[model samples]
Target: MIVAATPADYADRPLYAPIAPMLRRFPDGLPDLATLQRLLEASAPQAVSGGGRPVRFVPPDDALPAYEARIHASGEVPTRAGDWHDFFNALAWCVWPLAKSACNALHVRELAAREAAGLPGRGSRRDALTQFDECGIVVVTTDAEIPALLAAHAWEAVFWQRRAALRETTRFLVFGHGSWDQLRQPFFGLCAKAIHRVVDPAWLRLPAAERQTETDAWLAAQLAATLPTLTPRAFSPLPLLGIPGVTPDSEQADYYRDTRQFRPRRA
Candidate 1:
């Protein structure tokens, strides 16, 4: 329930910081299908569906094939008009076209494999893919310890003890449209499934736009190579509020002590 009348309404919100570049494209109001298609063309000319067809945004319709199937069989993405979730999804495609297509391709492959095996429902691989699609965050950093701490659920160690180091070395990029939608009204319990990438420290010095572009390319390649063996275990849960500076409350050491959100790692 984000009720923003226009993209600009939420542009300055801290949670929307990751997608600010996409938001800037639509200043006046929510983008229509045509506008989205145009933006896609401009931003990612080579962008295609899982089946290699050119990607295009389209209004939602019952007559269309199942969501992922349609994107795989045809390039049309069913988008709901004026919906925050769908808008962020389209923006995700624009920003991370190759990665998104790889995800769609993985979904199609998983679905086909399940059918061939006579499985009646989605399998674990598909579930993991969907979970990441809905709430994934990419944590790119030069420091290996940051991710290691995160994997161990060492909240204070990662967010507080290494706060300055993280600011200088890591970049958290949101890849989940569902997470983006939920961030519209951030809650203390909001968390994301993070996949970490240890990049060269030189990347930290690149301009903001270049950094994002580089990340998009790197992520696409990583997904293409790893999707076959990817699983839920590959992700580490990160409570959004515990991230330093994500919220003002997080600046206080007490914020990380909230056991309700920053639960201890299981024995």
Candidate 2:
């Protein structure tokens, strides 16, 4: 029977499947921006060295410069922060607070260093890191060889031929909602490739209790030095099957098979 599906049928599709596991941490699933705001308001103030500040969500009306300044000064990632673009950022922080803190702290230091050095403005590294913090992918791997393959853009080897190895060796942690949305309706030609930072696999092998501490230390070290370099590796064809919970047929796959976006590097 070729019955047409309705909107209600598609409603079951998860909006942000990449973070479905992390979303479970909330117990209450992902809350809307308004609901998230009320919850933050109800929470107790964060204890600071000099007393504490009551935690509150940054209103959508706040100017961007002001919001950035507040976070930079306070070293706090606001809950339900910013608008639709950054709502996923709040969720990311909830999922990986240590990592998010490490990222923010690094950015602040980079900005300060630039000011101290009398650099004209933001450095390339800072801009790159900021792009990463806004919408980056952390590819944590157990094997040393995987990173090289990733850097080389060996999509087939890393994602297909050695697919089983990927499940065992790599962990993809997505941070930005922009990244999340792209994963949902991926298009090879869109040029929306994520910023990739590969975490050493050895860190993951540590005891669960020590993993966060070790990872935080690693992040801090990387920040103190150079931020990870980003490269574009948009899939030649969107890897729909590779994505969890996405079961697109050939027709659906055709959507991302556009030659404009998926043009081969070799003529």
Alpha carbon lDDT of each predicted model? 0.84, 0.47
TM-score of each: 0.93, 0.62
Off by over 4 Å in 1: 1-5, 12-18
lDDT of 2 by residue, 108-186 (tens): 6666777899988767766665665555655557777776665554545555566668767765545455655454455
lDDT of 2: 0.47
lDDT string for model 1 (1-267, tens) is 355666877767655666786787777888888888888898889899989989989888898689999999989999998888999999899888878898899899889988998998887778788888889889989999888898888998888888899888887888999988887778769999988999887988888778878887887788768867878876789898777666777787777888899988888
Q: Per model, how many backbone clashes are there?
A: 0, 1
Cα distance off (Å), candidate 2, residue 180: 1.7
Clashing pairs in 1: none
Cα misplacement distance, residue 204 of candidate 2 (Å): 6.4
- Model 2: residue 38 alpha-carbon error in angstroms: 8.0
